[model samples]
Target: MNPGLHPSKVTAQFEPLIAAFPDWHWEIRNLTIEGDYLALHLRVTGTHRGTFQGVEPTGCRVTTSQFTLYHLVDGKFADVWDLVDTNSVIEQIEQGKAVL
Candidate 1:
């Protein structure tokens, strides 16, 4: 939903976030670079503001860390993947477990 992301990749990347949590916001806690990929060691904290992937918001605060790997090809991202603890976040938000 911004100018920084590649036009082609934007929709794919944004959809998951929008669907999972409509008001999701992110912060970069750390980063690492390897060859053609940049690994974003991120810290994300926000409210479960909307429905995401069939999960309804619990109106709770949750924080989690994730490493997102983006591989660039020909000046555009060829692939985007991440290792995130979504279950932990869900546990914290819905089950009252502490996360972050």
Candidate 2:
């Protein structure tokens, strides 16, 4: 999560992406749990149907990776760290290729 942004504002950031990739889907590639921590590796797939990141829709399919870690306290999330490969997604979209 970005330090400057509130957690509640995080979901709003995805609204543009949701509109751009209406059919986007996430697939869990790996999941692990250790003590109070949970980690996940995910693959995301979608088609560029609307503008995103200042790029106009090209109707190209795109795939990207995301990794996330969560710290649990009393069975609830206390902290979260997340990463997404936005560069790869942009490159694929610009090249008009589907990396899937």
The number of the candidate with the highest TM-score is 2
Question: Each candidate's TM vs. the true structure?
Answer: 0.73, 0.83
lDDT of 1: 0.73
Best by lDDT: 2
Off by over 4 Å in 2: 1-10
Give residue 94's lDDT in candidate 2 (0 to 100). Answer: 88
Candidate 1: tens digits of C-alpha lDDT, residues 44-68: 7777767655668777777888889
Q: After superposition, how far is residue 34 of candidate 1 from its true place, in Å?
A: 3.1
